[model samples]
Target: MAIIRDRDLIKDWNDIPIDLIKSCIQEHQKSIPRLDLLENYYMGKHAILSRSMGSDTGLPNNKLIANHAKYITDIAVGYVAGDPVKYDGKQVDEILEVYKQGDIVSHDAELAKDLSIFGVGRELYFTTSNDSPIPKATAIDPRQIFLVVDDTVEYKSLFGVHYYPKRDLSNAVIGYSVNVYTEKYVIKYNVKDLNGQGYDVADRIPHYFDGVPVVEFWNNEEQQGDFEQQISLIDAYNLLMSDRLNDKEQLVDAILMLKGGISIGDDEEEAGRTIRMLKKYKVLELPADGDASWLIKNLNEADVEVLRNAIREDIHQFAMVPNLTDENFAANASGVAMKYKLLGLEQLAKNKERYFVQGLRERLKLFANVLRVKGRAVDVSDVTITMTRNLPANDLETAQMISTLSGSVSTETLITQLSFVDDPAKEMERLNAEKDVDMKRQQKAFGMPINQDVTVDAE
Candidate 1:
């Protein structure tokens, strides 16, 4: 046997071909001898011993001898026939040493033969526990490594899995060593120290690395006032004037008598000037003024009500006579009609009732002419016809007759008759008396009224 160095043994373990290791174990039945023995020998011991041990004095010598032979054969095959190897502490140390040196460890035949006894591996790599006194080297790729030095900080091992930390790379400063996994880096100074040193820590921080300042800069040297004082004074004056005009009482007074143009007096000229001012500002306007009407029209209902209440109050207190005349009435009606026209009422016009009645009468006359042309007598008794045609009949019978014939009567005659009877009861009494006297005269002349009952002798 040759004495193999630890490094050489590790190299062989790293260099062995995986296929050769498998073939050697299969042919010799030598690899994993202990595992094979465990599988074959003890597996059937219980069944064999159970029957033999039931004898009077326990198992016979022959049966015991046979069991012993089987156990011996298994042990010899496992230990001698199998080319087994032991991977003790020394071998493991050697492998780790090689890893620490950053050298490539390849599998070879010798190490594979040794490991085949236990059926382990052809090649393996090792590392020291993190707390062990092992000199660590930089990973082959530095980008894969994370270096942290803070005592208070903590880290978790992901069981050899790699993870990259998110970072604002654009904001990173030059000459800083960043932990690629943790996204943290050591700073030359803390925030307080940076401020004490008059160095803007914002300049070094990842969030504020860009050189642009956050606050805007103004150049005082080139700036001018540009008459801002005068502008401010004017603004103050306008604000005060607005406040004064906002007073409800002042606004109403300014709208009313402040512009007295219809009176005569030395003060009239001043009043006229005031009126001009009010008109210019549109605080007051002439009657039927388009602009004034527009203002009122645009006002909300509440505001209109407020102004109307104010006007009513003024009229009540001052006892001013409202100038209501035919001209004014006509103007008001025209305004109302104009509003109605705008609201889509096409028939809205001056003297609306007259226009409506005339139109109705024309329709009735056309209906009556149509009935007459069709040879129907004008039955004036139908109230339905009288109402529909706007025909007036003296009585219900006449109204019914008018409806039967679909005829119309003159409205003038009906209206005159309706007015003739000042007292209805007196008119009814006089008419009944006249009717009785006429009936008597007819009875005396013809010996009876038409269709009156009479008796005669047949013989």
Candidate 2:
């Protein structure tokens, strides 16, 4: 394998022979496996570095030097000679070509800069010489694109710390290694103690070293899990609270509906049972008036009495009356009457006794209507209406008769008596005279129009 550095190589590359290009592609493919292996090693090393030692601290100079020396030995043994099965010159060349063309070596430079920022050299053993330009190679394409290879790379603390020796002459013992200590130092920090501290330790540590914090490496898997659990608990609590509030609202609505006169129970016992059921479901509470009040307020006694009378009438008709031909009469009279009787017989039925006040109220409404028709004043108070029964039967009968006669009285005689003369002038004169007489009477009653004599006519 040869390194192509000729100026004409760029132009010739465009027209490279098909066979050579094919050879290049095949060679590139073969080299792909080794390159992949190298990448994996590089990535593994980076991961170790990131997880253990801070990248901003200067590298352990001794460890780095030892690692580099080992790495070089491995490359030579693994690719150049030691084992033919493990080494292939053509594959190695292809890998190098890929790195050269892609200019991926710049990535190494970036890694070195980051490592210097991490304070990695504080404890590591390695050497850096200003005389030696970092052992680096470049392949330029004249097209402004170039590949760089950095071989003799050394880490430096961006924070100006030279904790580790420039070169480790002393043989230090590191992880069961003695002769020159050939391994990278991977630091492990305890993150458990930092939970709930608010401030990010990783972020703070970098600032102490005058470096930007790379929080991406902070371990937060456990914290994330705890956060999710807390959210779930809060959601559950909210759902339960909402359900309780909704139930209370429903109970209030039911109470209002009952007060508004919607009957939902048959009797005191039934109403009590219904209330109990609501309470059992945590939807209602027993009011101060108790269950009896709920029953009396909601049931209409007059309607129940009407239904009872209708039923009795139907039962009598069914038992005594002959064949009933009308379907409407049969259905409404018989069926409805039977239903009323059955309900009346039932101890738990809604009846007049359950809603006595409601019955009285309804009767008063009818009496008011009758009074209106008879041109009589309606007794607005409950006291007047309730005292109706206390009046003698004869007196009540007479009053009813008088009311009926008053309603039937003809208005024709009254209209005739009230009629006026046909002539408008005569009617106006009569009206004026009547008005004058009325005014004089009013003045006399009040001791004269005192201001009239004081008025003087205009000259």
Candidate 3:
């Protein structure tokens, strides 16, 4: 969302002007309000909460919130990234060892959630300063950090800016501290002026990664949040539900209408006492021709329920997320039937995977560069990333499919089909090891040495 194209940054390349950096920061500031709104929506702060019930102000104004935004986002994130992404390639174990040390699984999930919430996510990879330095990645708040890309067709990232306001004891913003991440160096700046036009370089530290250490993960090509398109629908649902409750409350406190003739004591205090006595006794003294009834508005329960169901369905449908609690999902659907039920969500996950995998490749490159310096260079190009959708698997069906395709497909591919197998390559190794042990036992039973080949008699 913070992509700005400047020909000058490309022309100068190495010598980036300070004013240009300030302008990019200012450009990023413009998008903060929209980001803040999306974040607030996810946090259950809907427009209905601030709604004004005008005119008849005495009516019950219940601000009920469903928090469907968070629900949909969590569903998408969990469906895509509930399980850790698997890395496969020649010598990928070394890279995975680094991932294990950095706890990439948790960070990956966090990044996916951020993408769902803000439409874009950012991750910063840096090397630890302690002994035995290893590259570590942490998800950065998209609101506080952004990458500056060039005007070329590729839209290559020129640099990254991570800036935050400096606050004093009273939490008053005095100035700003900005960290500009270039390919070679991380330049720190302190802007003391009210306007961000002027700043002084506080420090410059060299980061020996192959590229700028920040990676941007987009939710989609347009970079819109999962529920962004259906936000209005969500708000409408919240309003309808809240007002429905209010209507029920109004029914409970319906006004009493007395027709014909009714009498009370002459004084106003006596009238109040008579009303209290009527409430306490559940009886009203009236003339012979008097009649009483409650003034309640007719409520069509079926219509309200239908409208509520429509809104709920649209929010899930347009968002491409499924209502997991819906009857379609609860009917014990398995395998292909369950996949059909989740087709929309799977499509959404596919787009997310496309971009998420891109960001991960960039992260892998950064780790590869750092590991290269440590005499453990890896060929990142050979590495393939596998994303498994987090879903309930039908183990019997999967086993049958695997058995049918055993010889037709590669063992690694079959192993990957099994949800229980975390690492297909590792599982293959264990399988081979077991086969070797079985072969050795057969040779010993035939009175042959372990290394010697055993020839079985046809007789």
Per-candidate TM-scores read: 0.14, 0.13, 0.95
Model 3: per-residue Cα lDDT over 34-79, one tens digit each: 8999999999999998987786778788999999999999999999
The 10 consecutive residues of candidate 2 with the worst lDDT sum are 210-219
Estimate, for each residue in 1-459, the C-alpha lDDT of model 1 and write its tens digit: 001122222233222232332232233333234334332332333223233324574322222212222332232222221321111232233333433354321222222222222222111112235564222222211122212112222221111111123335686433322111111111221122211232222222221111111111111112111111122232233333333333432334332232323432369788688757866886544444233222111224466456544543332222111212325323544445634422321111112222223322322232233234444323322211111111122465544554555435543233224423333345656767898788778878977645556555588
Residue 454 lDDT (model 1): 51
Ranking by lDDT: 3, 2, 1
lDDT against true structure, model 1: 0.29
- Show where candidate 1 strays beyond 4 Å: 1-306, 309-350, 377-459
> lDDT, candidate 1, residue 439?
76
| After superposition, candidate 3 runs with Cα above 4 Å error | 9-12, 54-56, 169-172, 265-267, 332-334, 453-459
Top TM-score: which candidate number? 3
Which digits, one per residue and each the tens of the lDDT, describe model 2 over residues 1-459?
Answer: 111223333342222232332233234344334333333333333212233334585332111111221232222222211211111222233323333443433532332222112111011112223562111222211111111111223221111111111223475422111111101111122222212222111211111111111111100212111011222222233333343444444444443334433454799999888768876885654455534232212444466557544543443232221112334434654545744533422221122112222322332333333334434444434232111111112444444555566547543322212213223334556767898889878878877764376345688
